[model samples]
Target: NDPLLGVPIPEVTSEQSSSMASPQSNVQTNHPMTHHNNKWTKDHPLNYIIGPLSRPVSTRLQLHEQALFCYYDAFLTSVEPKTYKEALTQACWIEAMQEELSEFERLEIWELVPRPDKVMVITLKWIYKVKLDKLGGILKNKARLVACGYRQEEGIDFEESFAPVARLEAIRIFLAYAAHRNMVVYQMDVKTAFLNGYLREDVYVSQPDGFVDPNNPNHVYKLKKALYGLKQAPRA
Candidate 1:
């Protein structure tokens, strides 16, 4: 065995020799500044960016797009009004409320009368909602005036409160029967719904905020038809 042939020579090659000559240059360890400069080279995804912390500040187009998507995010909304005062501030909400009142008038839901003595007048609450299309764009502004029936006594305001709705089991059974009979069941929604019901019990509700009749500011509404928040609304 040739010891010289078998033993590995630790001779520095051109690349190694150059590297050794100026270790700082060739074997480049990052300086503090350089480390910081290259530290965030990795892509920052939106999953980590989160909210207004690092939100895009590129262009007006982006700003407009951000507003459109603010429905899914952000603290403030443009359409939904939390209070009647707030609702009155926006024309759209005002129009929606007017429309709702118009519906009430058309359906003869209530009659304006002098404030009843010793009778409880349930306060009305205004709920403002923006109806959105399937694609997330707003379709219309919906305003609902609901009676606060919490103050109503069980026997006085209502004898029984029940929802006139089909059970899930019944619905499923009907669907199954339809399928078995090979009948194509057509679905329809009642546009519909509540105001048609006649209220047997006497229910008094306060006039809506920002819409109190100037002539009859002290007048209250005597509800003949079931309103949104009445306990007997669904059944009446």
Candidate 2:
């Protein structure tokens, strides 16, 4: 919901521009018969044809272009790799991972500690998302490393799991009131919001995949603040 949460739009390079334009010209000249078959021909006796299209029908647009035309399914189908191994193959996801870890370090969310005995250690995984704008432009590529909170023991690791979020009906009512009162309504989002909360109970989690310290490969992170996917994170 945050305005800034989106995949970074890539700059159009001269090579890409030339490549995209080259296909349209070639397709028009080579596929005359294809266009002839696709042109409108009305069935009703009284119906008449409209003027020809101003330009030749373009070769089918690329997936991203289709998405820009508001084809939701086309946008959704854009490939997103599932695992760290897969994500590393793409530059976008690699940058996303770097940004996430940088934020974690900036927030001082946790500290590396020697793995303790007799206590359960929760695992973590990376979640990949391709955030888009209303018009279907990529806004951001997000990679979140979240704890496996379901593995947590309720009595020992977490006791509460409650958090408040804005209700849609409530938001509508507030907007209506503001409109009637001739007041502007503004909204704000807290980046890393959950991490702002202090954790009451000690929680230990395994090192993130691909980021384990070489010297402390067996060490775990002792969380001082709530993290995403922790059951008590919202309540904290």
Candidate 3:
């Protein structure tokens, strides 16, 4: 017999067989199968693979496109005044207030007799700004003559300056109620919102800047109606 061919396979001992029957010993023997099963479980069909694979949809370009369109529209169609004269002419309503000021002067709302013995006379200034539409187009150039309310003393110049205004929630509830009642809510805006009200206190202000009368430079305006920047302007 050839020496290699005659060599016999060794039989497993009883100790070895007993060890193989234990769970811990079986783990070493089944290591490859265990690893394969773990991999299969991780890649199961029901697993949420898209969670790691998916990317967030980008909104940055959409916002940039909207912004570019807005900018283009404003550049092409905006109605801002090219010259100062055009801007001043757009505020012609300031001239109308001169008549009311004259009436207030006649009523002697504030003593022009002289500034009070020691008390300071509150000065006035004209404020100018451009009103714009929702689309960023200039609608009008508005001019307002206002008292320097900062100079006014709370107790001496005004009393109880707080005024009630409709809250946003109240306005929403009102709109809902109106809708339920089948009411059509019509909106109207007063051209001069403040000019509609008469001033209860004797309020005097310096003449408005651009629209002051050429003849009367020294004459200060005695306000007959509530102006835009009075300390105690009515909310209504």
Candidate 4:
């Protein structure tokens, strides 16, 4: 026999039946009544909860599509050459290197002098690289003249070679301090950073390849300022 069998059924009054049938009365049902109603219903709790979820998914999809379109547009723009002169200049690596060497000499990074007796002279060479923009487009050609510092003897050729440089944390701290003081920060770069440092030791370097002095081909350079690839060059 069932436990609820033989239990007396309570008679429903007119007011109680009316209240039970009303929509407001359904909302006021206890937890047990609501749970039982949901179990028998076709619509589950998850169905109602998922109604507001479509908006963020749609927004994210639109953002991804927009980013892809922008990337494609930028790629096509970079692939299209802007002018005929730019196209021609891009093919001239030797000319670019020569021009860079001329600029380096004009900046007075070193003085052309006779190769001194019993003094070690570092060999120099031209290094070529292509400059690129943030969007991966070729911006310009770059040429650097670097010295072979491996041949340099530590104490005999140079002394006290280490140069101090500001760390990234120090730079961040400086910017934060400036911001706290409510000041605007500006940035400027030296055209040739190594060329600005005064050299204490007597250092000499050979003329860059393909750029021998027209009047004095036999002479080497006595460096007054630091050169790229020098072991003791100062850092800015």
The numbered model that scores best in TM-score is 1
Task: Return the TM-score for each candidate structure.
Answer: 0.64, 0.62, 0.47, 0.57
RMSD of each: 12.3, 27.2, 19.1, 17.7
**lDDT score of residue 77 within candidate 4:** 35
List, residue by residue over 40-120, the lDDT tens digit for candidate 1: 323666576545644444467987887877754432344587888887766778888899999888888889999989899
Arranged by lDDT, best first? 2, 1, 4, 3
Report the candidate with higher TM-score, 1 versus 2. Answer: 1
**What stretches of model 2 exceed 4 Å from their correct place?**
1-77, 166-184
lDDT of 2 by residue, 1-236 (tens): 88877979889998888778555476655554733445444442443534454544444566558667666544443557788898887777889999999999999999999998998999999999888799987788899999989888778888878997899999899999999999977789998899889999989999998888999898999999999999999987
- What TM-score quantifies how close candidate 2 is to the native fold? 0.62
Number of backbone clashes in candidate 2: 5
- Candidates in order have lDDT scores of 0.81, 0.84, 0.59, 0.73
Runs in model 1 lying further than 4 Å from the true structure: 1-79
- Tell me model 1's lDDT, rounded to 2 decimals: 0.81
Strongest candidate by lDDT? 2
What lDDT score goes with residue 179 in model 2?
Answer: 96
Better of 1 and 4 by TM-score: 1
Residue 79, candidate 1: Cα error in Å is 4.2
**Model 4 lDDT per residue over 101-208, tens place:** 677667777788987898888998666666689997768666677889888887887776677978999999999999999999999987767877878888899987
Pairs with backbone N, CA or C atoms under 3 Å apart (clashes), candidate 4: none
Q: Model 4, residue 124: displacement in angstroms?
A: 0.3
* Model 3 lDDT tens row, 1-236: 67789689999998998767666654666455634352323455645444553444337798899899898756533344443344444334344345445644654444333223444556766555557899966775454456678877777766757667789999999999999999999889765565556666666566545555676665665556666667777642
